[model samples]
Target: MTLKVERLGHSTRLQEVSFAAQPGELVGILGANGAGKSTLLQLLCGVLEPDAGQLTYQQRDLTQISAYERRQLLGYLPQTPVAEGGIRVDHFLQAGLVNLHLSCPGKELNRVVETLQIHALLERTLDKLSGGEQRRVHIARALLGDHNWLLCDEPTTSLDLYYQLQVMAVLRAQADRGKLVTLALHDLGLAARYCDRLVLIDKGRLLAEGAPAAVLTDANLAQAYKIKARWLCTDEGVTLLPSLLS
Candidate 1:
């Protein structure tokens, strides 16, 4: 499956921005603060409608899909996922599947729960968990439905170094399994290491889109982020180090 955004715009927050994500690809949306990264994700997930463009999934216009039908194919984890303080972690996760009247195999749910390391927190209420724990719980909830496309906004926020890596690994594994995963991220190094494609935006416009190495050039970073950076490729992987403020 593929998601195509043609000249999508959202009021003053985003201009005419277009991009696409295909199955089996991990697309990272990278930009500075207020650079339309979150806006783009919101538009893609149908949280906000574009004022002046079209969004298509597998050649069908997204607007033509019923809200309930759309939700079945797309899973979204907003930057600040709201969880009722009263709901337990397990209940919250199960609600994701239940709301759609979808049945995820018990083993599939168990796999996501175990991958996120949230097995112990299942009984705890959302109000009782730490920020990172809650983030993991919400992430596990998003992964429950096996949707064709997953759009996550700053999912690594509040996560520590270890959990952040673990979360990225899980997302990468999802992409490897042929799911389209798109996320808004501020960490260039993490995006470089895990994402198959990078979409760089600035001032409400798309600046670059391609392989990480090509799209994350010094010129592009300087233009989009206003920073001097160096790219290092090692046996392990790619690393983008910001040298100095531009």
Candidate 2:
């Protein structure tokens, strides 16, 4: 799956932004608040149509696809998961898989639960779970259904260090399995360590896109977040360290 955005817009925040992500790749959208990160994810998920641009899947016009069909292929985790009804974890996940209409009554649910490390909370009510647990459960629900593309916005927004790392690991594993994972992350270090590629956005425009070492440079980081940072490359991969701003 490749996403192409040409002259896309919404109100005054997001302007004509364009970019693409190949299959099995993890692309992180990096920027500060109000930089249109969330808006861009919404556009990719087809929740909001581009005011003036093209959004296609496999070289075919996506606009022609119905909403139901789009839901079948796209899995979205918004900044805040919808906390509706006193639904139980197992039931919520079951609801999410209704669209696929496939046969995953037991194995798939257990896989996601184990993958996200939420097996203990399976029987608990959603409203009773902790924030981090809820995040993991929401992700499980999104992954329960059959979807090829994942659009996650600030997935680890409100979680402790442990849960944050766990979420990142889950996404990384999905990417390794040849699935497209696009995420918006504020933690530059987390993005650098986990994502395969980076898409830097500033005020609704794409500033840079490439490997972490290439895009998370001091100059680009400063321009995007108004901060100074150094990129250190080791055999492991690129690491970002914040430098004195003044």
Candidate 3:
């Protein structure tokens, strides 16, 4: 399956952005603050309607799908996920499946909870957890339904270095399993290392889209982020070293 956006715009927040992501492709949406990355994700997940343009899933207009059905097909993790204070982590995770009308299989929940290393925190209330821990709980919830498309906004935010890598690895595994995973990321190095493709946005416009090397050019970085940076490729992966403001 492929998700295609055609000239999608949301007021002045976003403008004429277009792209297509196929199953098994990990597409990273890269942009500076206020560059409309969040707006684009919202449009893709049906949270916000576009002022102009259309979105299609496998050649059918996305609007043709009912919102309830759309929810079944897409899994969204917003930047600030809502975690009700009084609920325990496991209860919260199970509730997500209930809302989707999916069976809350014990094995499925255990798999995600273990993958996210939240097994111990399962019995703890969300209010008792740290920001990073709470984030992981929400992530496990997002992964519960095994939806076709996973749209995440800063999935690694508040995570330590180890957890950051773990979250990226989990997302990578999802894409490898033929799920379309699109993430809004600030870390260029992580984007270069893990993403199959990159989409660069600047001032509500699409500046570039291609492989990491092509989209993360010195010229494009200067134009979009107004910075001078150096790129290094190692046996492990690519590393971006920003020197100074342009």
Q: Against the true structure, what is each candidate's TM-score?
A: 0.95, 0.92, 0.96
Model 3 quality (TM-score) = 0.96
Of 1 and 3, the candidate ahead on lDDT is: 3
> Which parts of model 1 are misplaced by more than 4 Å?
101-105
Write the residue-wise lDDT of candidate 2 on 1-246 in tens digits. Answer: 576666677775788777777879989998989999998888778777777778776676776778888778878899887786588888888777766756756777778878888878878898898878888888887777646788898889778988888898889888888888999999898899999899888988889888987988778878888889776777765567786578
The CA lDDT at 66 in model 2 is: 83
Clashing pairs in 3: none
RMSD versus native structure for model 3: 1.3
Error of 2 at 94 (Å): 1.4
Report RMSD for candidate 2. Answer: 1.9
Q: Counting only residues 3 or more apart in sequence or on different chains, how many pairs clash (N, Cα, C under 3 Å) in candidate 2?
A: 0
- On lDDT, the leading prediction is 3
> Model 3: per-residue lDDT, tens digit, 1-246?
778888989995899999888999999999999999999988888888889999998888876787888778889999987659789888888787765755557877888888888889989999999988888888888888788889999999999889999999999999999999999999999999999999999999999998998999888998888888887888988778987673
Q: Write one digit per residue (lDDT tens) for candidate 1, span 1-246.
A: 678888989895898888888999999999999999999998887778889899998988887777788778888899988758878887877777765645546766787799899889999999999999999998988887788789999999999999999999999999999999999999999999999999999999999998998988888988998899877888877677787673
**TM-score (C-alpha, index-matched) for candidate 2:** 0.92
Candidate 3 achieves a global lDDT of: 0.89
Given candidate 1, what's the lDDT at residue 39? Answer: 91
Best by TM-score: 3
Instruction: Give the per-residue Cα lDDT of candidate 2 at 128.
Output: 91
Q: What lDDT score belongs to each candidate, Candidate 1 first? A: 0.88, 0.82, 0.89
lDDT order, best first, reads: 3, 1, 2
